[model samples]
Target: MTRETSEQPPEIAEVLARWQETWPTALQLWNPYVSLREPQWCLTTAEAREAGLQDSFAMIRLRGLAVVVDLETVRKLRVENYALQVLAHEIGHHLLVPANLYDYAGLMMRVRLALAGIEDRAPLVANLYADLLINDRLQRTMGQDMASLYRHLREKGIGETRIFLWYMRIYELLWSLPRGFLSCDKSEPVLDADASLGASVLRSFARDWLDGAGRFAMLAYPYLIEDALHQQALREFAHLSDITSAGVGAELPAGMAEIPSSVFDGIVDPREEVLQNAPNHQEADSPGRAKPGSLTAIIPGSDASTGPQQRYMQPGIYVDLMRQIHPDVDEDRLIGRYYRDVVTPHLVPFPVEALGELSGDVLPEGTDPWEPGDPIEDLDWFESALLSPIVIPGVTTRRRVYAEDIAEPEKEKPYHLYVGIDCSGSMHNPRRTFSWPVCAGALVSLSALRVGARVMACLSGEPGSFMETRGFIKEENEVLRVLTSYLGTGYAFGIPRLETEHLQNAKEKTHLLIVTDDDIFSMLAAPRSDGQTNYDIAEQALRRAGGGGTLVLHARAEWRPQEAERLRQMGWVIHYVTDENALFDFAKAFANRFYRSQGNPTCKRP
Candidate 1:
């Protein structure tokens, strides 16, 4: 009998009512997957909230089918028609049983029994059978319903699932469903004949009940299934393998070797063609061949190749061509070398007791010298020596005749320190030794804090490489945290204006210290209409504090002498420190000069 005409079974009605009461939001969210003409199952927000039904679930039974939804989930959905989609998907599952009670019963029994054996050796066997069944039968059934669902949703300009095969391949099994019948004993297997017959009878009763439910789902929630299918298709497309061989001319470099076939297969885009030609084949094969002595074919010699030559292009030719085009490219440089050169040398070849001596006073007690979290005392003592600047008493000095009059204490201006660190992708190269920047930044920050200077630290790389302290003044740790957050990023967008926006607004003396590779000098020096180098920006900004502003340019030692001279001419204090160990000395000297000059104002003149 048709479900609409048949009396509503009380247990089936109760289950539907419970589903509605338990997860109204999930049901609503899945409405797009549901079909129209499916029976309406009423659920309230309070009931859904009580069950914590935030995620969606599809319920299938011999008697009927339904989708339960949480109320909060429905409210959060971007699409208002989610409820309709959910209902349609439930109907799709119900429609799988249409008029085939015996088949439906047998399928359900097998699925249920397979699910039960999942925890033991039988799990593998059960899973294999279930996978086969779902892939072959269930997917075909779902595909049929999906076609209708797709047409309905597509007509409305909703979403559609174009690559249904991808989903069919990945999601053949209902991974979420529990395997095995928990109520039955593990050792006892259900008799195949009895299960088949019983399932058929139960399915007949279920078919009548679901006929009403399925119609409601189909009528009310077509888009739910449609959108899900669309998403599934997109996911499958992302994972699809597109294998192609390397091009004919492609080859490994001379002295270099081919990548292992297995290794190459993992990352090689399947779409790329493999190279097969050998180098110098054409020239060797067409020896002594000459073209017609026409103006287009030959100019001076009146002889040139005019016809196709059959010669294998060796893979080495392409490798050589690539090497010429990108001579400086070295992939190995990208991986960190810090462990070999910096970390290893300092920690190894010496006893732990030697660490304290090597580190001097800075390394703290109770820390390992080799580990990252090792005690500072056993590592290096330079930081503690630098700390002396903060505690040293100010000494009075005789003013030189050319010295400007010292300002009164009341008028002593607070200094603004702007530190720009280059965190571009190139900075990540271990060959460049990036740890210097990190350590230098940390030391500079600590020193700035000790001197009561307001510090603004920034990392520049890509369009959004900036990371800075926001209204951050007090906590030194906070500033360090911001600095450490910088990731080596891709190409940076804007010019490195190290001096302008950061220091220009300060009423106090300004110190713009830029730590970067020499590569950035040209970008910083390109003339602005205002006739200002980045250094000029700082000079103008610090002029407000009675010319107390200074620019310090720290770059790699390999920078051209001309670059240093040009910066010096621009009135910047330039220093070249090639390696990390030297950076601490440079900072120490710079800090000494800065602090000592506070007492002897005319000690060093620009």
Candidate 2:
């Protein structure tokens, strides 16, 4: 198992070769795509560093679809079952623990939540939980002597913290061993009765691990809540896991994504749900964002008579989880997801059943009976046949007749929705993969489409590529596709791009919505091809379209006074917020004011 060669050492390699031959027999499935490689073969020490691997050889990292292993280290430790057991554990991680990128993110989300106050060691604690689940599976189902691996690991054990000891005790209980099975102190393990219960509970829910995770974390909450305990634990285990190396070692393999995000939607903090469903639970006034002192995580399925609620999980918990899952999750996108998830239930989808926005030409789907005054063309013949028994002198199904309002005379007003979003580098959250502006843009675009309005979604990142839907169309999917895509090249939103590409070509009076930061000043400052400034182009577009507009800027008060004032003079609505999060509020308010109560998509002022 020595990592001395680019090739696997003959001695350890032989053991693994034998195991590899029978690996498929055990897994009962063949995956030609997976292969084994030595540490140097899979990735050089340098490559490992680049992938953020810890310096320790005790850890293995999966990267580039291959698991990186230092066989020599494994051989030295004389692990139980050698490559067979250890390799299986790593493969299990790929097969189950993470499953996909979103689940991988879910892994961190659940762990950080479970660790709450002792989040500094969240990754470490998470690794322990994962190992427990994996080992228990192998020992219970696969019939492997996985406990032997821990026996050797504990022999070199340095120190014990309450949480760590409690963690180990669960292992002891799982294996039917005494409490002091793997402790360095050499004294009888002073164990929490909860550990025995946790071990029992762990087995009880092994088949359904994700949901059980939230519950297990609740049990471990008291053991990890204090810094005094954490410090003492750190001091006790200094030789075991260095605090600095904890994060790096705890990292999963590079390129560990094959799963879609939709799979993790059901993954939630069980405690949060319990708290949410509490009999006395009261939602914060501003449900769009985390309000101060508004968050609490009660014990899942806790008895009401058990003293006061064991509450935790304060504000910013989700933000912390997001940041931890990946350093690059877009802040605005998270904000958008949060607001969208929160406000979506509150939003009554546009009253599509009501033919309120119907053009006087024809009727839409329905089975409502026609009255004597109903138009003959609006009668539902099929519905009338279905209800033939109730036939009467002018009784037939007809869509409730409603007259559409016109924004302007001489035109059949179908509201034109123009969304101009800043797709510049600033809109990109390197930590996260998606754009929030795109999400927010999607919400509004979808709303407009639901109400029979044409949506023109434009992604403008000045001095770079600009994308827009083909003028305005009613297809919701097409509109959503354009809004959620990202263009991370430009420096700011291109006002000229909007003028030349969107506003100038608008076929009808359009409700133009621009999403950008104060940096839009620079885009406005950029010169245009025709001698006209970007501002002039923007102003003229509003005038030409003759539809009221809104500039939703994530900028400071000092940043917007002049341009916001200028845009206001041009009959544009200026809504400023200190952060992108408030865009959701603006969106909800705008939808309520302009689209919700409307009888039709007409180019008329509210």
lDDT of 2 at 370: 79
lDDT of 2 at 26: 38
> What lDDT is obtained when candidate 1 is compared to the true structure?
0.35
lDDT tens digits by residue: candidate 1, 208-270: 432222111111111123445435433432211110000112221221111112221121111
Query: Scored by CA lDDT, what does every candidate get?
Result: 0.35, 0.56
State, as a TM-score between 0 and 1, how close model 1 is to the true structure: 0.29
Best by lDDT: 2
TM-score of each: 0.29, 0.51
Leading candidate by TM-score: 2
- Candidate 1 lDDT at 391 equals 30
True-vs-predicted CA distance for residue 223, candidate 1, Å: 54
Q: lDDT by residue for model 2 over 310-372, one digit each (tens)?
A: 111221344455455545555444443432433344342564332343344553334566777
